[model samples]
Target: EGKKSLNFIEQIIEEDLQKDYKKEDLKFRFPPEPNGYLHIGHASSICLNFGLGERYDAPVNLRFDDTNPTKEEQEYVDAIKRDVEWLGFKWAKECYASDYFQQLYDWAVEMIKNGDAYVDSQTSEEIAEQKGTPTKPGIESPYRNRSVEENLDLFEKMKNGDTPERGHVLRAKIDMTAANMLMRDPVMYRCLHKNHHRTGDNWKIYPMYDWAHGQSDFIEQVSHSFCTLEFLPHRELYNWFIEKVSKPGDFEPKQREFARRNLSHTIVSKRKLLQLVEKGYVDSWDDPRMPTISGLRRRGYTPESIRKFADSIGVGKRENLIDVSHLEFCAREDLNKIAPRVMGVLDPVKLVITNYPEGEEEWLDAENNPEDESAGSRKVPFSRELYIEREDFKESANRKFFRLTLGKEVRLKNAYIIKGEDVVKDDEGKITEIHCTYDPKSKSGSGTEESLRKVKGTLHWVSVKHAIEAEIRLYDRLFTEETPDGVKDKEYLDFVNPESLKIVTGYLEPSLKDSKEQDKVQFQRIGYFCVDRDSTSAKPVFNRTVTLRDSWAK
Candidate 1:
């Protein structure tokens, strides 16, 4: 039986509804910075915000927190939208912080004219020195007492590109000795004479993230502002700013924090991922081994599997590292019922069925996916010459070995049973091939008594004459450490997994000739795989997402 789907976020929404928080009044926003590609951590947030919208019958706005133009880009913005839509959620309206630049500027002016804010002349170093440690009270800035009229004029001048130095800043005139240090007169605006991606170079000033985030949510009428735990301290500052800026009875969006998802044995930091791409350590941002959403998609991960992972992890207040195996488990669960079973050999060893007639071929019926009865079956080519996994045969046999060994019997998947007669080796004593003889009466699904005989092992095989040659890329975790970002003293790069990706040539069943880019399937007894963007009609390329469960790990 399927288990119930429950997450802490859903429970919160449910209680809110029970307490008369009107369903139609609840609104959520997925506010991403768009400075980097979306990672698995962001997927959790995406599911929460959009899932709330779905449950409440409310709209979820997709807002880009494009506060820092230097780091943000149109490419990132487009990628984020693509990822969200792929995850099966639609944004009610597209929003950008740049769209409210004028309103934010007007609010800054109001603050300056009311003596609640002022233009500061302290350099960044001087400001830092004044902003003391948590154990100490901060010293007031020299310009803290500037007259309201003078401060307003200075703010306008600053906005008009009059200040080119860091000392000139517009700061909220909050307490400098507050216990919560974020309220110690945070900077509201900075003078940056840079071109904005959306607003262009019409103004030289930009609102700080702390100042713009809450008001933007207010302007959009968002009822809930969801963020990660790192922003908890800033929440107090956020609510304070919103209270002072908006009317008393107006709805102020509440800020709630949840512990961001962290996966074991994987580094999800954008900085580290960028380093891997720029330093040529990896192919690109979408490399199959990367943890980025685009990377996972390119690696053959389905959106359903990823969303299911987010739901399974649930929402929590405490932080913990989740095993990457849980993610693999979700993918396997999703693909088990969908992916068609196919035959492929990575390390091929030639097998010659001496008892079978030469230059003859037969069609053998193979179930497409035994897990799905409606999938039916397909015919596979079977012939005298076949290729099996190299590991399936042994010249020096062991007593417990169930695979093909000298004089041992084994069954070919979807074909007749065979017995290994002898093995062939080169001068270096490396086994090159195996000789076997087939029992015609033991063909699979032949409805004969011999066909029902049990064999210890069944191996997937491809006819040498009808097989398709292809390139396969196998990917592993990118990091060797459990917490690559936790150790401050050691560089994260030191934990890089050197064997993250391996590319090799392999042979697949002839049915794969029709496979195109992004098509996924399960290589029988091996793993689930996807056709890569690099696939060609002549030589298709595939990526192995994850391997099937085997007892080796046990």
Candidate 2:
């Protein structure tokens, strides 16, 4: 009851329905340009579109707003499809703006012949200078009044590849002194000799994003065209283009804006992300520490958790910056329910039980996942010799310390109670091993009275003989400062976290030998981890997604 109600977008849709808008008229889309992999921000949009579709029993289309040939790629398109499916959403149809290129070109020709558009031959700089700032009125291009027949012939030649890239641009005829600068004769088409990812070199002219976006939505009969707040000013131009091109009875898609999701501690801009990858600030686009969806997936984020997060944040009209911990909390919450707990000794310290029978070994049953009964249990080998986490042992522990220490008795999880007796060291005096004696009567799960004995310390361990060597990667925040964008004077690279990624060869339970990539597991008393894409059958590598407690860090 204490939580906030549903967001404004939901309210708007509900109100629309109440006012007699048919459910059949509702169609939404998540249109992304196939220029790069989808990021967490895109995840929010996907959930919004698909979630609304499910709620209203409407269909949502997955459209590629790919208009720039220089940046778009087929690889990105494939990856986007994979990501959307992975997030548990199915699109009604997969459409590309390029599919409507011919229709858009015909419409542009119509506009030129009707005196609503013209071709401008001015340089990009000159056009920008004339299209003045938000507060200033813009100056019209010199070619604004070009004769209709001449403009059409030139446009046809431009499409036929007779013109060089940027040699001429088709601009919509609009008021130059409009309050919104975007409406000041916005560029509709441009000549590009480069090959399109989908269209190839079939045509030399392509429509700009503004001209192509609204028309695509109108053609698909979208009822509500949603966009981030940055496009608020461009809404006027988007609607104007629709009114000029749409036939009678065609849906005039309403444009609605919502604030974009901004996290307090990360950078989401593709350009900055690209810089980070190119500069070696991260391993690749899918680096566990990066914000891309693939990166989050590689970092052990579950689709269910991310969807829950998007649902929780909901849709809002005003801007807000969410704390990164909220995302971590959601991920941790989801992993805690499904991840199988296993023993791993990152910093191994040898423990020898002097009182146990020589060369004795036992198979102790450990719960795989306490949260899910269907997960059952697994056998963990316990023997006279075991390896515990180095952090679990202490030569000199404080009064509040609840882990293993000299002269202290602690419970070996799924095993017997053991008391630290002594330590063995090399010539340099650094302790190499700990000597302890197991209490014969304190065998775990045994019916004996001593089996019920309680101890403050409980430690996880691996059988020294059954342990598998593994390379574990520990990741931290990518940037040292919480607000990477806040640093204006110094480059964001200066704040790159030097210790963001740490690699260590550790001893893991042999059960993990065949774990597949992206498989998630929890290291007892450590953290949740996922098998990295870089892992191979010969060497299983894992990335520490996040620790059990937020307080622990290297």
Candidate 3:
């Protein structure tokens, strides 16, 4: 059978193919502005473009639209490349709009010679005022009709570093009264004396994004230029530049816009994210709470999970806000199949096996991943003294409570069944320890009737003597409000969740002592976690990836 039904973009490509568009000519490009790190929203674009390339066996170039030297940096460029590769994509070529600086300058000069563009000496505010609103027609700039020769001289002067910054901007001499505001004399080039990350001080003026993007696509021979819906209005201008620059038989890149993937309870705006980093709202760009690719990776989110999420959401034309829980659900689904099952106690309380030998210890067989039988099993050390979640026990709980309580029987996962008998408290009346007795015949997986006995609750425990102490970071949504950015007259930062991150010491199974950074595992009955980069041999750290169940809604 043929492949699955196509998305709108695929249908467009299919129609083009019927019109004699060669499958081999179906080249695409993913262009990212290197002003900030790549976020989850960008991942969808990456997957779409790269996945198309894979499906058609075509080439997809990774292009950095680093035209605005004021904000673009080499660090951001490197991060973008790293993110793409980490997502299991290989670009046909790594290209940058800055690479076509000379070609873009030459094209601008041609436009000036053709009397289709001119230099305007208007402040940004004046330019904005001239543009007018959607319902109203814009007034023409006073300098719109400058002679081609004069505009040429001024442009050359601007390029030669003689023009003051923002004193004169090269504008395409399009209709001022055009229905689409972007078509009304858009700025094509501007003078900025800043040092470019790639070009350094070689050029004093830079082409605006509208001028650079389409031309770069045309120069690279990209067949399709995919962008978010915000750029839908800019498509006309994108084509206009291609028309002005294209030579005979030169391929014109097609611009298609898709709705941006917006996640609830978080802001994906680079400016706001930067504010969070600069103002110390987060530890860094890789803070687990961040929606950045690096942050997700650091938080134990596997590339498989993110790719699955991108696929599950698919491509759409209408804007929609996806619940963050959906993303967590995907992570849980992927982690369940592969992540090893281990025991961890985030809030530890000592459990003393009163009837067991005090100095004796035994190793019990434990399944690594029940969903993946091939993952087999491992030996977990069990001893008289063990640590369980402090909340798992109480002085007395109702019959509805399945966990440990006085006179209640609970099975220790991979070990024997134990009954809580007594509790020891400190001077503050807080239960410090619980005394219990175990039925040795009830050891898990043993071929005995006692082993088949069922209990209302199964508790995961780590032997206190062999437990590895680890620093655990529990993360939640960065914002309390689901639509923080949608609120009128309110700062998105005002909705920042103060309890987004919580740090606690945890006791882990001994097998995790050798865990390396990025290794993912599921803490039985707790959550999925990833070994953190900050982990060391002496002191390991883990970031809670997601809970065992969806608790946010509850």
Cα lDDT tens digits for candidate 3, 1-554: 79678899999899999996888789999999999899999999999999999989999999999999999999999999999999999999999999999999999899999988999999989999989889999999999999988999999999999989979999999999999999999999899999999999999999988999989999988888889999999999999889998877876889999989999999787777889999999999889899999999999888999999998899999989999999999999999999999999999999999999989999999999989989999999999999999989987888888999999899999999999999999999999899999998998989799999989999999999999999999998899999888998998889999999999999999999999999999999999999999999899999999999998877
lDDT of 2 at 302: 96
- Tell me which residue pairs clash in candidate 3: none
Query: Mind giving the per-residue lDDT tens digits that candidate 1 earns over 437-521?
Result: 9999999998899999998989999999999999999888888887987888987788888988888888899989999888889
TM-score of each: 0.97, 0.97, 0.98
Q: In model 3, what lDDT does residue 321 have?
A: 96
Ranking by lDDT: 3, 2, 1
Off by over 4 Å in 3: 1-3
lDDT of each: 0.88, 0.89, 0.93
Quality of model 2 by C-alpha lDDT: 0.89
Superposed on all Cα atoms, model 2 deviates from the true structure by an RMSD in Å of 1.7
**Clashes in predicted model 1:** 0
Q: Alpha carbon lDDT of residue 532, candidate 1?
A: 95
Error of 3 at 159 (Å): 0.2
Best by TM-score: 3
